[model samples]
Target chain A: MTSPLQQKLKINGSSVVTANRTWDGIVVYRTAAKGWSADLAEAAIVRTPDEAKALLAEAVADDVGAIGPYIAPVQVDDTGKILPGNLREQIRRDGVTIDLPV
Target chain B: MYAYDEIDRTLVNERVSEFRDQVKRRLSGELTEDEFKMLRLQNGVYLQLHAYMFRVAIPYGTLASNQLRQLAHVARKYDRGYGHFTTRQNIQFNWIKLSDLPDALADLAEVGIHAMQTSGNNMRNVTSDQWAGVAPGEIEDPRIWSELIRQHTTLHPEFSFLPRKFKIAITASDHDRAAIKVHDIGLRLIKNEKGETGFEVLVGGGLGRTPFIGKTIKHFVHGRDLLSYIEAILRVYNQYGRRDNIYKARIKILVHELGIEKFSREVEEEWQQIRHSSLQIDDEVIEDIRSRFIYPSYEKLPHMPDELRQAAADPDFEAWRKNSVAAHKNPGYAIVTISLKPIGAPPGDATAEQMDALADLADKYSFGEIRVGHEQNLALPHVAKRDLPALWKALDKLGLATPNVNLITDIIACPGLDYCSLANARSIPIAQELTRRFANHELANLIGRLHINISGCINACGHHHVGHIGILGVEKNGEEVYQITIGGRADESAALGNLIGPGVKFHEVADVIEDIVEAYLALRERPDELFVDTVKRLGVEPFKERVYATR
Candidate 1:
């Protein structure tokens, strides 16, 4: 696939590609299977800049289902699990930060 | 409440159909995101941080019981079973789906409510005093003029595009509950020395990034020439208002750049030509609109009912009566304000169940009508004094019996970082924390008539600039920091708050406010003195000293 560098975002550390589903506006992360999933656990973690660029490219290429694809910082634990690095990303991953009526 | 006429119904239905087609084209990729953004915004669809939020106007904050029931139905069917009432007398659904927006609009249209002009740089929903007709010491009902302005501004070809969004508020009472001084245009109905009711027109007041108290351009404009005078002001702003920068595009900026004298002169020069045109309101038309808002049939009863007297002996009912009820024009009746700011719950939020119950209460106690106050509370404008005890019991069952009107806990907050895409910090959590800190009703009552407003960003969606205690959220080095302002009041003596000191961390905000309130308590001459009055008496220096003492 031809990589479009213009859509590339500045990345500092371990990250995952994320976008919002266009239909429902839910946050979704790119998975290792080259598809979007709502669950952050299924997100494909990239440790290096090149890996993040490739994942972002895959996310942007799937434009039919999502909007505003970008790489977001993630933290990896000793168990090799991923979590959003910042409060905004964490809130996005886990719906509203406060309690909301279901 | 003004019922939708045939023209209004046709216009709403047509707009919904147009939006439905636009959504279809956007989904099919026939239109780019840039092309669809404006169209969606005009339809009141905002793409926020988590999802789409849809804002529906409650025209002049008046709603029929059936109309409110329809809103509840829309919440249950399309959204997440709840809606957030906004400071601008509107209701917003936070978790709306882009795909379901068209269907939602159509459903809302069936009840004569729409989301038109709620977003975009157009005349937004005209807000007015929540207790428009019921409040005593009034010249006339402001909602009549609010509805007239709504009709004139709706889909007006000339003002559909302006330098920035415009807002207008009308208040007939001298108390000024509508925050008229902070609106783009404030119309106050006042009687002349000759007993003729006219409007004192104030212009160019707004709060976003640049806050200014509106200046009275015309001391009194005849009620007949109200529309022409407004049109003249809008024309001047349209021609000379800055369009280059979004931040400096409000009429307030124009009035600031060119002094109010020069701006008033220009508006006068423009009004000289159009003052006698068709825009001059006819007396008969005014009377026609007035006739529609006739008082509901009231029974001839004594001022104090026996049941109310007996309930006043009960401490619980007396507590509710102290905070939740207000004096009405009719001696036998009172205005009831329902608190939406329950402890630990988001301000202005109502579940579908709560909304339905409120509607049923309106049918039973009120005259099948409800009003949304600018403070994000619901009011039953005309409830008999005898029915208050039963109403309080019913509201208690629904967890809506919090008696904190104008108290420290009755906070006004905007959906900040949690939902809004443009927010720099979160407002809801701070409000919740402050509410928890002041959960004691006795302490809150001791602090009498304190208004705490929180905005997530500089946009001032929460009217923080005019709050008795204003908290603004800002981002510093990627972390949220809150700045506090003191002594802002939204009444007749409207004044902007003064920034006390440096920004505090989110965890310190509640403590800072507590210190400020404690200082006010210590300094007040008597218990009857309000916090705002105390701040006015003792300058911001004392409050600032107490707040930053620990820093």
Candidate 2:
């Protein structure tokens, strides 16, 4: 939570709070249930400044397992699902952009 | 092929235990993330894009079979079942859990391998020529000096931290296989007119946001004076290298800022004081390190047995031999390059199964030794010519025999935006697509020796600046695009490539490369003129025109 991304984000649309789980370094998002979820679709999307601040605060307050929390923009498709708004976050939501042998 | 002594084992094991305690504290919140970051990086654990990345040093690109098997075990047990061989002659395992790092370090220590200083702003893993002792016409084996440097620089209290990371590479041959011209410090073994061996020392070469070819600081330093001379350079750099701007912290910037003359004057002043100090290498110690080298027992035999030549009549076997195999210093022996660049797979990646199988093959065919070169490929440094057909077939089954050494598809690339946190765009997909586009397809074989390197960002970990054709990922607007360069070469005559034409979108990169190849083919006066040589001869004017003509 003390990472450089702790600074404010200039959001144009809806956003979500995201971080990597400390022990495993897995990407996770702040969920509507006030907990972390590994899936970005389950992330709590916020549109307003106040909503974004409250949701990111929830992430920053949790230091036990979450680290380097930051706000990233997201978009909602017609199906009412959260989609990462940028290539970087989308790849973080998915795995690597290309096929790599496991 | 250096075996770990008791001291080396104890040092690694003790550090492993100490790091386990540090990780426990970090996880329990007794230590802060900022403090723990330095500790973890010193141990070669990096928090990357999706998961933690653990980098392990493969000393001078040499590995014993059992050591490789241990790596396979770690890859299978702690990671995503594969290890990425980097251009630095190191192996990295992505997707390792932060908590699993301590256990992984312990496991690797059993094989006399540790990831120490593979990251951090300290002296990194010292790399050398892959075919050091086996290659014909090398002035002398450079691994001896590499090992000496490894011991001197590892945990040297004076240089525990520096303005930025430092890298050193030593190559013994005239061909400069180590890419020494672009390293922080390059040491080339040479003989003076007095018939005594010495080193031609070059300093301040590096590749990053700023690229520089190293300039020779000293023409010849006596073999015994190498460590002192190098240490003096480090001392000067540690004092005068920039610390304000992260972009300018490398020694190359300092040398550039002060000009090479002033930098040389500073280094000379410091070296004269330390020339006769305890850092001077003694013959006994060099001999001790040299004696530890696991030299293979060879049978005096004929060169390229008639059988291998006959087998070369088969196109598949012949192509692999001519391209993927190199002449060895020993008669009837071959240095087989087991390329990790498959047609569509990630360059420099080996699955656990492949690692285990390659270990077996190395033990059976190449004196239980394997080497990883800076080109992101693995080499079996000593293989009998007779066993090559079987080796190629086995490698083919493992999906490693791509037969494209020094070919266009034998690319050197970094784990770009896909894994690195600093990348502006993804590099692997571009590399994968280019490989699928060019490897052994169309006139790729006819294109002859060409090198293509890609980097995700300006950090240039992929050595993109020296590629015959370099593709660098950049962001234009909101989408990913690539900036291509032509005519770079990483060799004895190292030169940075010039940017050609405008940057193109990711989807068009493969075609753009095809056009560049086509332009080279058309522009060259003879088929024998290499793509790099053609560019060198004609400059980038014609290729620039050809690539951007339709745009």
Candidate 3:
């Protein structure tokens, strides 16, 4: 019976803070329910999103097999809103968002 | 022109063979890719996205017609029928194969040219004023010192791998068209207190992540001690400059961390150690390099001509004279800049035929010599004033006759995400769009002396940070977007531009730029005020309001 905010807090993944900052994986923030919001960091302020996803595709491929495709299915909420974890997909889905360390 | 003696010829021939063998070893797999990359880069070879690029040095932007003919031959034989003249006064062929590089080197060597140090983190081809010999306002021809530095720094054993890539620009004129401020070292040849000619050396200036106007380290370093002083500076940098982080490796950052006074003291301490050594430029060596740069004997022509007076009466010729031609040292001669930025085209691209036409123009008018400016434009530095009409006719046919040298339309754009692998978005299209949006030559001339630079990424190959109106392209939501910064300059007074507000979408960029221009027009004190001076007088608030009105 954990809330979405609590779930995000529990994930312990890297957070995108700004476009200038570096991120290990693709950082996505859901703006509203079913609306993905990317984290944007100004000079000092950090705005968190409804949902965040870091695609584990590169890490998975390195760990497992290159021939076999790996997918990191990320859910914003429990209502079947899933996002791809690959860097290219994140770039396609969300234009330019801040990436801050969690 | 300095004819190559046996020593010069032998050195070039031997270096060509050495590079030829290096290429052979690379192809045979005896040298690893990493090992061969440095070797090839040292020989001016780069593996660009599509093919191997060979960059040939046009020393201080000076070249002979025979040398250019040789380049044209290489373009026809080995490359894609054209060569890209870069910002460093070097020509790059982007389609050369790895196998044919040696042959290309051999061809270049035949004309006393080599691809040496055109790439790599070495002392690159020394760039000076493209109008060095013919400039009327200059203190002296800087090519003499440029050639001296080229010999002194080329493969100097003690200072090869210092900090990062080092660039040096020398200028004798009051105006710094060579962009002396953006280099690691900027040497200005000036008259000293004792009425002696020497260099007022500036160090720690560059434009990348952290842009800086170089500080004057020495008030006056004697001309004879140029080599010794430069060696001292490099040796000091080599010892203590950061090597761990690539971003912080430039001598500017080193000079930033250690204050200018401290840095200069260290350099002076090092100079004292090496003052009287072999590196100290002797009187004989200076004279030898000086003799090489003396201009050819003139025909003792008249200062003014009636043909020029007639051409001045013609309106089209008058506009071309005002825009294209400059006063030269010789009375009957003029330095004509062939504008490569035709409307809706890349800034510095001359077609294969245009190259031939330029070569022909050089041979016919400019004493069989051609010069390439740092802004990617070609110059007929010694064109006779009487021949301006004929030169205009030839250039007009080739589409090389845009009369906007320092106007708003003459944008300095890099081969952005289109061709370069490191580009985040396309830069050429933005330039083309802007050119089309502001197609009025009169309007462009009205907004005089504004530099617009675009770089796709932050590596800053295009020098976007220093542009008067700088645009940096980044990707946003699978689409191209450009961020605008205003009020940057790269002349003697170099300043990094201030960011206006947010990134504009690719489609809105042209409109935003139009609005910015309109704002400048409304608030300007006079019509003659430049964009930089006006921006300085009135702050960026008006520009920001105009740019972000609809946001």
TM-score sort, best first: 2, 1, 3
Error of 1 at B230 (Å): 1.3
The pairs that clash in candidate 2 are: A1-A68
True contacts kept of each: 0.51, 0.75, 0.00
Comparing to the true complex, what docking class would candidate 2 get? medium
Candidate 1: residue B148 Cα off by (Å): 0.7
DockQ (C-alpha based) per candidate is: 0.51, 0.74, 0.03
Candidates ranked by lDDT: 1, 2, 3
- Model 3, span B489-550: residue lDDT tens: 98888888888988988788888989989998898899988888888888789999988877
- DockQ ranking from best candidate downward: 2, 1, 3
i-RMS for every candidate (Å) is 1.6, 1.1, 15.2
The segments of candidate 1 whose C-alpha lies over 4 angstroms from its true place after superposition are A1-10, A14-17, A30-35, A41-64, A69-71, A76-80
CA-lDDT, candidates in order = 0.90, 0.89, 0.74
Better of 2 and 3 by lDDT: 2
Fraction of true interface contacts that also occur in model 1 = 0.51
TM-score of chain B of 2: 0.99
Per-residue accuracy of model 2 over A58-92 as CA lDDT, tens digit each: 78777767877888889999989889888988888
